[model samples]
Target: MTYPHDPIPDLSADRAELFAAAAAEYDRYRPGVPPEAAELLAETLRDLPDPTLLDLGTSTGQVPKALLKALPSLDYIEGVDLSQQMLDQARAALTPVLGGCTLSLVQTSAELYKPLAPLPEEEWWTPDLITCCRAYHWMSGPDVLARTHRIAAPQASLAIMGDGSLWMHEADWTRALRDLVQQFLGAGRRAGALGDCPKPVRPFQEELADSAWSDVAEHRFPVTRSWSPESVLGYLRTTSFAGADLFAERHAAFEEEARALLDNLADGGPLLEETAFTVLLARRRAGAR
Candidate 1:
């Protein structure tokens, strides 16, 4: 499960600081999967025997929290993330809920850690349920799918979900905000310059379809979360475009405009929008040799 390419981003030092500063806000605005993701995850896990779960790119450990809450009998849960700051936040948030369950945190790139090569073989931690929520796009397509196939135990279930419709659902406002940033920062400084846009899941779907997995399933969940204007602005602050250099000069004005936009909306109580998400659930062939 080695990565074919390095997975680290070429983020500036200042951008790294910006990410650390925004860690709390990122957790605040980061929506939990709202019943649908939790339900689907629960259903998928039900088919498996008692499982050791691995949550990849488990930012703030939110999805695992939900999963464990739904399936309290889960014996072991591990969350891996690349960001130390984010992992710290997750540890703090999950500490209270770790009662009677084994919770382990690992800070590493998902690509490099897949198949969890660094783990001791004697640890007896083979995962029967592996779930990645909202973090799959950070992975190169082939790397993630192939890695999933490798690490997962035979007949293990993998569920990958992303908040793909975040911007697409709010296209008009998002475009306006992007245009404004571009206007001030110029064309090449466009937001999401690092290809942070929601990646289509088709490639991974096709990969799984052609792979040896059986009972493959893919489905879309329509979901929504409400956000205050301030919260939404805080969420934007966590994006790559809002690095310290960009945030210092523009964040205040951006907040002002975001508040105004929220006020102008019909409800006038901030913004509520629907988002679409795709969940790919598949099981490795049982007893494949």
Candidate 2:
């Protein structure tokens, strides 16, 4: 399918290095894909006798780890990302759980990645399932989706999913936290060194509708997450909008004030964030590829 829109000018804002400094903290604090989302992905692969997975923006291997738990029969797994630090974390976290499964972690952006040619007699390396969890917003949708269609198996499935970040949650505590971050970093949302958050792209559903993977289904799982003040702080440290690096010398002060605010807000209890984890599952019609 030819995209009607002009080629997007790579609005991801220097993402290759955006998460480099916070990768370890990101792995420690970022939540994994919800279990129901994994089950939904697993359902799509049930018919493939020996499925392989290609995970785009596979930060810390969270999505693969969740899916592996749901579908141990998967034969091969490949993770693509821009940060080597994140891939290193993903390798460490995913290696032990992948009993007998072949794993490849590549350091590259999703749009430029190409699978290695399979060995003689082996089917060409085409993933049966492609997933981009919590990271698709950092990519050029039309370019990535077009590239994905070329690399995926004839009947492959694509899942783009994420829950909004803590920065956007409506809880009173989160609002206070956002206010504190703004005080330190100014009003514009930070996108690493870029200093301004990228504008929101068209919705993923609309992007999918324009691509070859136009047969789409959406599933949303309502999740209630509990966070202590410390966990919330750790998660904040991994975000571009509020990470310590963005705060310069004022990071310590921000954390101190945030801790006090969260303590008062929690009143000796967990801070709760009620969110809906949304998954956009897409595929092409038979022979449409």
Candidate 3:
């Protein structure tokens, strides 16, 4: 939970390529898809003898990690992402437990990976369940969904999983944490690998609605995640903003200040916050309206 180093910032707006540079740090800090969300996908695919799962934005294989845990029977999972660096980390993470199933990692942005292509005769089945974890906002959602509609099996489903960002939380402690970061890094926020992650331009729902994958259903799982000051401090190192890359020579000073800030906020115990696990599933249907 604790890291001796802070995350190095990359500050590049190339959303497609932003994550790869911090691939190691990201794999260390990024949380996997929530259990409830994974269970939902598993339940939906329970009947299939051998399921194919395609993970969009499959950074470090978190999507497959979650899905395979829930549905170990899954036969193949292809994780597609923009960064080869990120996919490299994913390859290492998934190599050990691949067992009977195959874990294929393809490095390409979601936009270009044509999900609409016809199924190969001898190779495999269509994706029974496709999952996109935290990186949904980075994609051309309508295009992705439309293509998914074309390539997916008859009853295929898509699960988009996200909680909220620690930086974006509006709680008192979160406010205090942001204030500390701003004081140290100045008023402008960073994102991707540079600074703080930005809020999406449009709600994910709107994107889903605009596409053919409109049989939308949503589930919210209330969760209270606990963070130790040390772990929280470690997590910051992996963020796009606030990561060690932003401060350069002042990184040490910034971390020192952050530690003190966390100590004050911790008062006498660990920091506990109410967080929700959200999974938005979409399928293709005629009259979902």
Candidate 4:
């Protein structure tokens, strides 16, 4: 709970577990990564005929699903997360696409993952690509990146991705939604599982600069997600801070008021929002430690 690297140390790990409590809601309502971002990820690993990928903090497998669809050449993918419930949804949703590639899920934190290595008869396998979509901030920044660099293949590329979460954006609808959440959960945005989530700075580029994955490049893609008022409410329940469990005794009241607020913000229809999805690609130097 007291991560030395965390900008705000008071944010508890219990807050991060809220997503596990609302795992179903999270699977059902969280936004998907832009398809183009997945394509760019594929391009970044173009040389590998059958790239093995690791999805860090792979919540409900949204990004993995997109990558599977766009990067047909990927042969193996491991979805790692701290919550088994979240991994269950990911496995269920990703089961349909297991035809050409092998899919595996590990209920663990990224900072501690050592790939498949260090286990007897199961040698450690290096991934050609590592993706942490909107999850890097939730991790111990430098530690995870360092582990990723260690497990990655010499030519492996780590993609640290971000497309702002719903609670952090500043659109008119988003601001109004924030106000609604504040009314129930106070002024702070609820992250569902990760407490009082603070955005992680671009730690990878800085960390990678001194590590094996030092060649850095960034690709940005514009994305717009349209959301109905009801959908917004559903999404909020999946978040750590605004989750129903967080509301405790006031959960029902919170939902009712939130629905009402969203309905008013809807202006009789869905809301359109645009945000940038960015991928910071860092490639490991050949044979470098």
lDDT of 4 by residue, 1-289 (tens): 1112232333345633647777888878888888888888878666777788899999899878998888777788888877767888888898898668888777667876656433467656788889899777778877877788767777777888887777778888788777877887777655554556565576567776877667889889998888987888888777666777778898888788777877787879778878898888887666667
Off by over 4 Å in 2: 1-13, 287-289
**Candidate 1: tens digits of C-alpha lDDT, residues 66-145:** 88777776767778776667777878887788667777776666666644344555564578788888776666656666
| Deviation from native of the Cα of residue 130 in model 2, angstroms | 0.4
| Whole-model lDDT, model 2 | 0.86
Instruction: Rank candidates by lDDT, best first.
Output: 2, 4, 3, 1
Compare the candidates by TM-score and give the number of the best one: 2
lDDT by residue (154-174, candidate 2, tens digit) is 889999999989888998888
What is candidate 2's CA lDDT for residue 239? 89
lDDT of each: 0.66, 0.86, 0.76, 0.76
Can you tell me which runs of candidate 1 are displaced by over 4 Å? 1-18, 47-49, 114-123, 185-202, 210-215, 241-245, 286-289
Number of clashes found in candidate 4: 16
With a 3 Å backbone cut-off (N, CA, C), the pairs that clash in candidate 2 are none
Best by lDDT: 2
Better of 1 and 4 by lDDT: 4
Over the stretch 159-231, how does candidate 3's per-residue lDDT look in tens digits? 8888867887778887898888888787767774434545668888888877777778999988887777787
Candidate 3, position 256, lDDT: 89
